[model samples]
Target: MCFEKCARCIGIALIPLAVLSVVADILLYFPNGETKYAEKDQLTTLVWFFEGIVGAGILMILPIVVFIGLKDNDCCGCCGNQDCGKSCAMLASVLVALIGMAGAGYCFIVSALGLSQGPYCLTELGWQYPFNSTNGRYLTNYTSWSECTEPKHVVTWNTTLFSILLVVSGVEIILCFVQLISGLVGGIVESCCHCQEIVRCNDIEVNVYEVQE
Candidate 1:
């Protein structure tokens, strides 16, 4: 009963996948910031590049997953202990919470990182550099829509979006964790109380029998 109530069957496969999805989503939230620094440091750029790529992946698939989850769940999602629990609701809750956390955590990290460097200055990446700088400052005016519109992260945009997403995601994650833990604890407490009551009843029966004898 505990196992059934605690975890869902449908989610066994989706949880880890959702984690990857979220990681990707957060990475892409600010692509401009990522590419700007890639020009200076290969290693940092690599990390940033991966982050952006992952974020993009999440953006692509998250909506589909959410739609499916919504259709399967009740309003409270995985909050249901019995009827709803067996449904898609509980699984959805867990997924949503985890995804939300991933986005939120990234936002928090980016905002904190911003203190060290000002908003990602595309100029620093030499895109804004002088004379015939085709990639940065001039690329927008020159390149085709593909090059011009493709993900070019802006630090300012990344910072702002990340910060907001983080706070919101962070809060939701906390609530989800709290709700989950509390439910478990409540079950434990109820079980213990039942056991104690059974022991008390047994003791009383023994005492009465001994007195009669």
Candidate 2:
């Protein structure tokens, strides 16, 4: 009973984590044009975009797996000594969770590395500059910048967006680990509970026959 409750709680927790990740992934597409950054970063922006798509897809599916695991647990009682369904569900959920965790971890790594290199990229792309003589002691208009309409603004937005993605990925990785452990441990405990239930039912049936005799 406790295990089931815990599984449900874990499932509920994964919902928001997954949603936040997907939303952030979608938002990552904007803030900086894909084509523009794809050129300089050796397609790092494209990589990030694809990673977002994959992360969002995995996260979206994660909730469904959790729900299925919960459903399997609820159905355990009805299945009555037959742990096939529940076992299969647990295994499937665990597999999905592992895959999701891997994806989330990859995203976290990429986003974090991007954060480290993003400032340099901004400078290289003319989004920002040093305190050099040309840029300093003199005011410059937006027209002076190339590659982006408003280079400074775009870079700021990009930096903020990447930071958000990094945080979201980190949280998701942690959540996925939690869910993974819950599913594995819960599956084992649930199996033990089902075995006890089966034995108890058999004993009750034997007692009933003796009473009838």
lDDT of 2 at 71: 56
Q: Give per-candidate clash totals.
A: 15, 0
C-alpha RMSD for every candidate:
11.5, 7.0
In model 2, state the lDDT of residue 73: 53
Model 1, 80-190: lDDT tens per residue?
434433333434444554554464345445433432232233343333312223232332333322222223434334434444434443443454354344335544554
List, residue by residue over 90-132, the lDDT tens digit for candidate 2.
Answer: 5456776677777777777766655444423334445443322
Q: Give Cα-based local distance difference scores for all models.
A: 0.41, 0.57
Return the lDDT, model 2, position 183.
Answer: 69
Candidate 1 displacement at residue 133 in angstroms: 24
